[model samples]
Target: MDINYLLIHHDELLTYLREHDYAETYVNRYKTTIKQITDNASNHNWTTYEDVYQWYVDQSYSPTYLHEVRAIIGKLEQFHLHGNFPDNKKSYSSFWKIKSAYTKLSSEYKQLYEDFETQTCKGLKSSTVASYRTKISSFLYELQCKGATSLSDVTEKDVLTCFFADGVRKRSGSLCANIIRFFKILSESGNEEATRILAYIPNLRIARKNIDYLTDGEAAKIRQVLEDSNYSLSCKDRAVGRLLLHTGLRGIDIACMQLEFIDWNNDRIRIVQQKTSQPLEIPLLPVVGNAIYDYCINERPMSASPYLFLDSRAPHNNLTTDGIGYSVKKIMSAANIRQEKGRRKGTHIFRHHLAIKLLSNGVPQPVITRTMGHTAPESLSSYLHADMKHLRECALSVEDFPMAKEVFQSCLK
Candidate 1:
């Protein structure tokens, strides 16, 4: 029960004690405690009974005194009930969320990000870092969706939903494979509970699929419109789009970028990609560098922090993956691109386009894997590796035979 009820009850009980010849000093102590509780009770706040009782118990109240105090607290509870206060008014969800938010971050995320930056990214070639990044990012993206900024409340469902299957019925068996690796890392970092919950997750391996690449003309069309889009889009937004398209950098890598990391002198740039903790240095082409320079000089606001990207609003924190997607969609709509990939064209498709461009340019499979950060050198070979019109040409080859070849040569002519 609330403390105000107890305070009012104490007053009447004190008067009865005075009638029984109790000394003024004894009655005054109870009066002071009651007054303090009453002031705190105006907002219905109560120190938990266990906390209060533990303190009172240490003061060594005799058996009779304990019984009397219990009776008085009971009277207070009854008074609270009669006065219209109810116990279940607050939502536990909000309380738990607040508690989790205030809780400290786990050592695991810090270690993984650090390790990725120092060991994985630095020692590895430019491309292998990208694979490490994808593995980590897809996992973190799941955490962000669940509103789990802290480690304590993270459970198996949060892990599975974030890293598991893409919700298609066809790949039902492959959902649990990567989560095993992720949970092992967490458990090794001393999160036993997260580990325990993770054990029940199943084991399944799924084959990877090919990627669809956009043609140069098609890419140019999208680029022109993305720049001209009417969302009053910031130079930073357009630049981010261009960077993704040109370099195939992941969203989190972009998010964690800093000004000092740019190596303008040598035309190479370094990034400690957030997911893999790798320090990847890409040879920044003039186009990509100019786009980034424009954003840094013209768009980015001055701040105490060094993150290359910041929110447009005050108290700006880091932008989440969804925020990045929302911007991409806004620009894509203005570009008049179809809005059909799960209700949106993904920013990650830029990576696919990059892969295709490398293939079409006759860039080797190992080179694509290295530049894109694939652990398995052959991983990216499954990409369309050929443009759409070329694929059509190849498919019609068996059907139209000599005529199709002449048609293809005539087109090149």
Candidate 2:
């Protein structure tokens, strides 16, 4: 635990990391970084986290190298402080930049932003809150740039102009909806200006697009790949693929699923939906259960982390939603299932497939909505397009029209 122990026992740290399955190349890079820090610093007595951080800053390394050096030093700091390597991704520094930007807004608008953020954080997921904060912050910043000192000064023209800015058109509906919600929050807080602003902004009705889903054959192929012992997928990948395919869980739900969520005795898995914040209980089929069991027993990393899944590499941490999506894409590629243009290939595709399957089997819309953790029955309406059998049932009889057969024959001729 000595201050210079990291410098003195550098080789030992590398060996320990290697033993824990850290890639050889990464360990070598760590070695090089350690040498650089020891060569440049006057004293290696890095005791506190702040002390190590300060020493790194004083080195005046380039941004890229600074990040690299800081990462290595962080590992050493973790070892000294906690007697183990770090197990989570480092929090990004951009968060502080965002907070600073928020503090710089006009006092009235800043208070509005605070209230909007507080309301969002009450039940929204962290990712959703971050997105809302970024979009709303940008809107406020633009208003400030336009010399608008108060909410009343933000006219309809300003809102329209902002909507036409780059990248806003694609997300116009969602962006406008968020703005409406923000105005609603302000109006509820007794801001008459916000009530006026709300009248000017309309939530654009977005057209409902057809849901993309895997056909029975495509799903079977992907499931086969997951179950094949010779397919060369990592344990984590197989387990994740099966979980999405069988349980119809979203990527974020799979990412946040903890070990305690699985009820072994009851053969069910319970989780709070990341997007809706509603609790969901899915029956754990044997195929899905066996895949997860195999992973936990034979393939999962040996870590004290309570998450059901973790990164396969060293400093193992729970997978993120993006990581889960990447794994699903890899599984699809291995099965030779290339997603068609304009069709989504993420984990949500499995959910769509499951919903369509249930609909085809005569499952009620409300039941489908409940199973998928949807808050409204209207959310299940999109799957109607994917249910060809049900659509066929609504077809008009050919005999209803006298000229229908003659016209069909003439067209064929």
Top TM-score model: 2
TM-score list, all predictions: 0.50, 0.78
lDDT of each residue in 296-400, candidate 2, tens digit only: 999888889999888877778888988898888889888888655655788888998999899999988888888898998888878788899989999999678
Candidate 2 structure, TM-score to reference: 0.78
Backbone clashes in candidate 1 total: 11
Q: Which residue pairs in candidate 2 have backbone atoms (N, alpha carbon, C) closer than 3 angstroms, thus clashing?
A: none
Query: Candidate 2 local accuracy as lDDT?
Result: 0.79
Top-lDDT structure, candidate number: 2
- Tens digits of lDDT, candidate 1, 1-413: 45545655565666655764556775675566566456655544346543444444667989887655544443334334453221211212211222221123345554554453564255665555554455555555456558765555667677566534576432233434444655566667777765785675656556554544455666776678655645567777777787788888887677767778788999987887664565577888887787788877887766676777776543344556666777677667766665566543767778778887777677877788767766676667567554554476666444545465678789897
Candidate 2 off by > 4 Å: 1-21, 34-85, 88-101, 117-121, 165-171, 207-210, 339-343, 397-413
Off by over 4 Å in 1: 1-171, 178-218, 226-231, 340-343, 382-413
